[model samples]
Target: MTSPSHHAPGAEHLLTRVGEVLKPALTHYLDLHAHPEVSGAEARTADRFGRRLAAAGCELTHEVGGHGVVGVLRNGDGPRVWLRAELDALPMRERTGLPYASRDDAMHACGHDLHLAAAAGAADLLARLSDRWRGTLLVVGQPAEETLTGAGAMLRDGLYERFGRPDVVLAQHAAPMPSGTVAHAADRVPMAAAGAVLDVVLHGRGGHVATPHLAVDPVVTAAAVVTRLQNVVARETAPADQVTLTVGTVRAGTAANVIPDHAVLGIAVRAAGEASLDRALAAVRRIVRAESAAAGAPREPEVTVASRSAALLCDPHTTGSVRRAHTGLLGPARVLSWPGSMATEDFPLFGDAGAAIHGERGIPLVYWMLGVADPDAWHRTTSDGITSDGAASGAPDAAPPPAPNHSPHFAPHIGSALRPAIAALTVAALDRFAVT
Candidate 1:
């Protein structure tokens, strides 16, 4: 029941043929990048993938949870494997000075473009290898990864109920690390649990500049709450456990003379464990209430927490498979330890409880950091060569490449950085599914 077009000439030929196959894909992918779309608003993007996957003879389901797409390919009675790629773009203005850099309001700063291309390329490769593999292949194009809502929404909307859950789920993210390097560890926690929002509006009386104690002064209370919230991480939790409490934004009075009637406090929290997170939230509530009361505020502050993401755990079995596959193909030098990260990914919600909470079903999350930053310059500056002044490596003339991730001027070495990633993930998928 397979298409004659799916009969690829040679699986080994993919290594050499990848470039030609990817050229058109890369163009299309970059075009999508140019006109990036945000989460829940990816109708056009999802439609594009729907057509692309259908043309390749893969079964397609569109509009899953707003703008998500799933492509299914069944090959006899082999194990079911799930491969995912995020389709949404960030709200960032493009700064990468490339000919194909994003021109639209939204940008692909996180390299989801690479992820989408790799998934499609893998689909093409696996479609060709259908004769060699068994079981079902589910390639998912998920949306709203940046907003941390897409995956969770899809699951809630019956992704497993409709498509049937996979025995093994695999997803890869493009990182700003080294080009040829892959990061993996047996017990890897690629991202932590995170929550953020603007809440806790403090009410007070506005007064004239000459007023001494007429105004409640919510701004003063907010400043105190910010200082006290830090104690939650410092005093409540153990020194070793990682937790973060930050006040990113605060808004209050307009005039210096008059005391403002109201002020708003924005809070953000991150933790590695659920228990710790609960404790952190409790502490936030306690601080807001007590501080407002102390400030002699009349009414209770309205508190609300908006965005939330659970901690990401890498399944040992899958992580081990990825490590073995990566090391076997790229060698130990290129496969480095999974450098710990404070950032968070919502991918953890994919795993069911008691799945290993840390095991493959438990972790099912393997995040590899692809070294995209210039290694030569990094090595020189990091080494004990020059002072902190103008010169490191005793070479004041040397300067590092543009900053990586979140920097306005950051640029990726597309050919060197992206090609190796495609190769690594392709080989890793083949290894995981025993396709080759």
Candidate 2:
């Protein structure tokens, strides 16, 4: 990667403004970290984000979708650029042991809090530097991203029609890499997998433990289905294809002696494309029904898709421009190239994949990865054979890697990460704005 001769226009001023806004941004990040709400229930999160945007001179609108917040700041006449951040958190306990960790079950393990803070900071900078550019800035706080339904929901609620069609939409996700670094997909597809979450119910007859011969055990059938589902990827899918089937939850009888009347299963499937995902989903349904029948089930098994998302494909031209802006602002060393992953996201809905719902097409979308791991901690664990707890390992080469997104131990080093995150988004948006 070659370095740029100079920074993007007003890059130095943007950096200074980022520092000026860092205090309140950090405060917001901490408050959000301490009070996270799960998907479809982000009332507090949305309120805080909307208030911050309004404070930064945006025209705020609440509940575009379920608890979605949209803030628009218009200067003169130019392209409308939307900056998006997630509002929902994961339903998991916090184990990071930080000073401001959440006391409840929900936790911001994926750095949505960081993204929100950065967005707030960027909004403040743009509002403060209105004289430098001319455009409409749309700051969006999206809800239910974890369930992969928020983006579509917002579009169905007329996000584009109500506010205005965006010339470009920008977003970023937190990664486990060293803080202050940003990564963009080299192949144009930042996330290459389409995914679906399914719920399965198996029905059977219940009976006492003594009358085992008369009773049908749905638990046993569920186990058999889970075991057979593994073959869907191993034996059914092509060797070159990428597919994953995870039976995340299984529930049955409460007592060990009693035979369960029915069993419930929560399953997830991911694949490189829609065809592969459909094939795997079909295999799951077939196997579930077959296993239930083989086990003398009382009724046919039921399967339903709870949520689904398409592969995230970023716009090449827009991504290239943002990448150059990032390189110019942070230098080539901190702007890294990313190999696409099997992760799936609903962000594609903002582009062509969701034309059916939003009645719009060719809207460019740009997504990137933002590093949130502490450099010292990451280096100590991966290079010096030290654990995250600051303990020296017996074998340095076998040290465990840094905690990843969704882990209970995941924590971002805010001191060094916040400034860069703010500047990254601000510079990218400024790159699209018409210069004065």
Per-model TM-score versus the true fold: 0.82, 0.94
Local error of candidate 1 at 385, Å?
A: 13
Judged by lDDT, which candidate is best?
2
lDDT of 2 at 48: 97
- Candidate 1 — what's its lDDT? 0.68
| Cα lDDT of model 1 by residue, 1-436, tens digit | 2221122234334455457456656655766767778777887778776666665567999877779899998777655677788888777788767788777777777767677766776676667666656667787889888767788777767887788756667777665555666676437454445454436788777788698487788988989999898899889889988788889779999988888988997777877776777788888998898998998888988888666776667777667766776676567777776545556666776775323322234325455656555555445554453222212343455556336554555555666655566666666556555342
lDDT of each: 0.68, 0.87
> Which candidate leads in TM-score?
2
| Root-mean-square deviation of Cα positions for candidate 2 versus the true structure, in angstroms | 4.0
lDDT of 1 at 142: 92
* Clash number by candidate, in order: 13, 0
Q: Model 1: C-alpha RMSD to truth? A: 5.6
TM-score of 1: 0.82
